[model samples]
Target chain A: MHTDLVAALDIGGTKIAGALVDGHGRILLRAQRATPAQEDGDTVMRAVEDVLGELTVSPLWSGARAVGIGSAGPVDASAGTVSPVNVPGWRGYPLVEGVRRATGGLPVELIGDGVAITAAEHWQGAARGHDNALCMVVSTGVGGGLVLNGQLHPGPTGNAGHIGHISVDLDGDACPCGSRGCVERIASGPNIARRALDAGWRPGPDGDTTAAAVGEAARAGDPVAVASFERAAQALAAGIAATATLVEIDIAVIGGGVAKAGEVLFAPLRRALADYATLSFVQRLTVAPALMGTDAGLVGAAAAALTRRNSATAAGV
Target chain B: MHTDLVAALDIGGTKIAGALVDGHGRILLRAQRATPAQEDGDTVMRAVEDVLGELTVSPLWSGARAVGIGSAGPVDASAGTVSPVNVPGWRGYPLVEGVRRATGGLPVELIGDGVAITAAEHWQGAARGHDNALCMVVSTGVGGGLVLNGQLHPGPTGNAGHIGHISVDLDGDACPCGSRGCVERIASGPNIARRALDAGWRPGPDGDTTAAAVGEAARAGDPVAVASFERAAQALAAGIAATATLVEIDIAVIGGGVAKAGEVLFAPLRRALADYATLSFVQRLTVAPALMGTDAGLVGAAAAALTRRNSATAAGV
Candidate 1:
């Protein structure tokens, strides 16, 4: 039979999105609901079911042989549970079983959101054709994932490439995650905005004090605003260089809101990378912008489901 | 045919040791030579040839099915060449080709010294049952390798886990490798001794100025000596935590001279690890001493050869 479709779910603090994705990565049907992030566990589960309800009612639902979930982490693929830092309502929640029952007992695969984005990048974006790569999202938090030896390395608990929390500055500031000098502590978009505002860079008529505003001020030749991005770039370069040095990745793909700052982040990032990645094997590493858009999470989840199905078929399971 | 033996070579800056190892990782025959490290390329080649010559004459040589060489960095297994920093006479030297010819064209594998030790540790030491681990040698230089997904992750160039060169303090002291504040720069034995001496810690009547003496002083309650080890421990902790956060290893196995300091180094390391490895996935990570002694490289090389031979046999090649 031509069971080539996969059901994908992208669960986050802000939204719960579901889609029926075909083998060519096209979304044939879609549904989404605002996450009841502050509600109780069953309330959040109800929102997830609502999205899945829409998906299952679609004419294309029967073609989906498997289901994949990309949830905000930390996820325990081994336990088929997730306890995303933002989703306190669902601590160690049985997401796989919930989704399995919602989809008529379809085989389910769960991975961290960062890993799902990496799968998308490896399959059809900036990291395409690269055997070893790092794909990052530098937005509210600096999350990332790895592609090692031409395959997605989701790690034992599906959180292998959690680069945001890795300490680059051992004696620097303390992170809310209880670690000091984490990359997310220094380089995330919120940190960038905070550093800029702390340095006396103010918002214009719009009264918007976001990182995007700082990016605008930096592009318009504001020294303090530029310096904040430079500092963030430095932290990112150190973290990226550390990853390359430890794992030998040939490319790094950057995406998300902060990455939209363009050369303000990239120019300094590239220059600082040269300063840190000095070893023979890692010196040749390159950085690029991510091509996958907002649909990356859903598409990547579908890719994961497709890969699992293919592997199980190959194993005659 | 039993095919119960493999020829193993552990090439380093100070010595070239060779052995014929049985299938159970026992060394039944051995050869050794002082490395002509400062001589021309041909002289060094001659020393290696002489070591191989002794192994070739052993009565059990005919039973060897493959050969493995574990040499100092930076090695390029893809190109079959090596350019160890201490051995400047052999820049991109064709070690693999030469060893292949010396062994009468026996299938050969080459890996960095750190990777070789990791293979040994995974086979029969501290990391034996762990599917993912980082094995480190903290001596004059800090070197390490990774075992991921129950296999040695040598990377494309056989140098994936060169952790010493990754910078933890991006703006701190400059490293000789053209990076700033690398783990090796801050945590190596030489640096530990230098920091202790610079802080006015005096040697005993024996005038022993090594890290071992520093360890002795720290054990004897010298504040200066303890502070120096604490600083080294901090750098190591940051580096190790960074590794765990990026790749998700469950344990870190430490060996070599400085690791011999016991609680003086490990106590501070474990404490500092709690400060950096705070993420949920990495919080459970443990540190242990490597069990393989001085014969790690040779035995690990033998393990690599055996694994390769067994894989080839399975492939019917």
Candidate 2:
């Protein structure tokens, strides 16, 4: 049985991204649709169908044999349902069944969006051929995936590497995930801006309030912006240290928008990690940007489909 | 090619423990000796040799084939040397060589004491057959080891699961490792007592206090003791929650005499873990007691030696 083309979709609270990727780990065609913010499960399902329709009819996916979906938090892969916290009306929705129906039963698979990114990066991105790697998306929010022993750890419900909530400080800011001082609450884009704003640091007479602006200001030597970035970097470094200390990772490939702050963030991160001197095993941590960019989600989603590409060809479902 | 008898030595800050362990994970003979606090390198080596001499001549080590040494921090396994912080006289000491000469050149292996304990638990104790586990000794200090994908994770120097130094609270106590708010300084045996003493609770009429006596008081309904255990539990829960969220550990087997507090500690731990409701991945955290007790170090040392046993046989070195 030959399998080449596969449909991939990345589901988030803000947007839903879809693509047609072939066996070569290349996205042949792509499309995006805004998440129907307050829409019910059926409405989101329709969005998925519309996106897939754009791909299946395109020349790229005309020969595609299977589909894969990567979604936000707390996915039950075995049951093919998702209970994403950010997206309303998405409690225990049968996500795989919806995609299967959209593709006319072309064998769809589901995985946590973070897990998908990890698998994609492991298979084709910077961390390829490395058995133990931590894939993190430091974007609008932090998300992660674990590749240990050359296989992905999906945990009890495919939520193994939700490292955004890993505590950097117990007395830290309260995270949306009902925890305090999670890395997300301190380092995510919005959090960076929030911290700077809370610190009463204004970039100029006119405030362009946001993490992107904070990054720009920090680059331009805005004290508050710089401090916020340092704080986030320190927290990120601590978490990275703990991760390295525990997992003994060879390299930490950091993706996501906030990473764009670049050296302003990495310098402090390196310093804080150095302060974790007592741990000798993982002190030799190598930090790098993820090779894959915006399309990591789509690529990761596609990798998940390809892993089961054979099943799509076998039962001819 | 048969392997059975081996000498196991545990080097701690206050004392040095040695034992003769058989193939069945049983200690055939054992002894504990005081560590020479102000001794030089040669002096400590002589002390180690004296202990080895007793083990080899005993009934247990009459047929011993090798030696396993589990020592305090900062070890270079490849170089067969140790830089123990507790044994200041032994900086860059050739521990493997010392034990070899003492045992008359029988094969010798050395590992981080924490790693040895972790391996011991996995091989014959609480973490049996479980490929993923973390064993923590929450005594006067907290130290740990990770077993992921069925292999012990000893960071570059075999000190991987050093959770004691992992920062939990930014405002928490300053750890001896130079980190601020480490779990060790917040929840460890002595920390529990110290925090309680500061809270105006006399552990006893005379303050020759220890974590064990505190546990006894709590068991006997001393409110101060109960509160101290709760604080420690809360801190541990936060730390454990962060770890569970990051690594997706299947079980956390806590050892050390401090864990004898039992429900006094675990109850608050479960409550604090529930506060992380935003994180769906770590909800099913299970806290269990360590099974090997004080023998953990000896058994772990033995298991660590056995890992080298196969390699030694294969290399014919």
Kindly report the fnat of each predicted structure, to 2 decimals. Answer: 0.78, 0.60
Task: List the lowest-lDDT window of 10 residues for candidate 1 chain A.
Answer: A1-10
DockQ values per model:
0.84, 0.42
DockQ versus reference, model 2? 0.42
Measured over the true interface residues after superposition, the C-alpha RMSD of each candidate is 0.8, 2.7
Q: Residue A107 deviation, candidate 1, in Å?
A: 1.5
Candidate 2 C-alpha lDDT tens digits along A186-283: 88988899889989877566668878789888889888899999888877877776776665666677888888778877777778777754465566
Candidate 1 on A148-235: residue-level lDDT in tens?
A: 9988988888898888988778788989999887889889999999999999999999999999999999999999999999999989
* Candidate 1 structure quality by residue, lDDT tens digits, B1-317: 44679999999999999999998899999999999999988899899999999999977899989998899999999999999999999999999999999999999999999999999999999999999999999999999999999999888888888889898888889998898989999999999999999999999999999999999999999999999999999999999999998888999999999999999999999999988888788899999989999999999999888988998998899
C-alpha lDDT of residue A135 in model 1: 96
The candidate scoring highest on lDDT is 1
Q: Please, what is the TM-score per model?
A: 0.98, 0.84
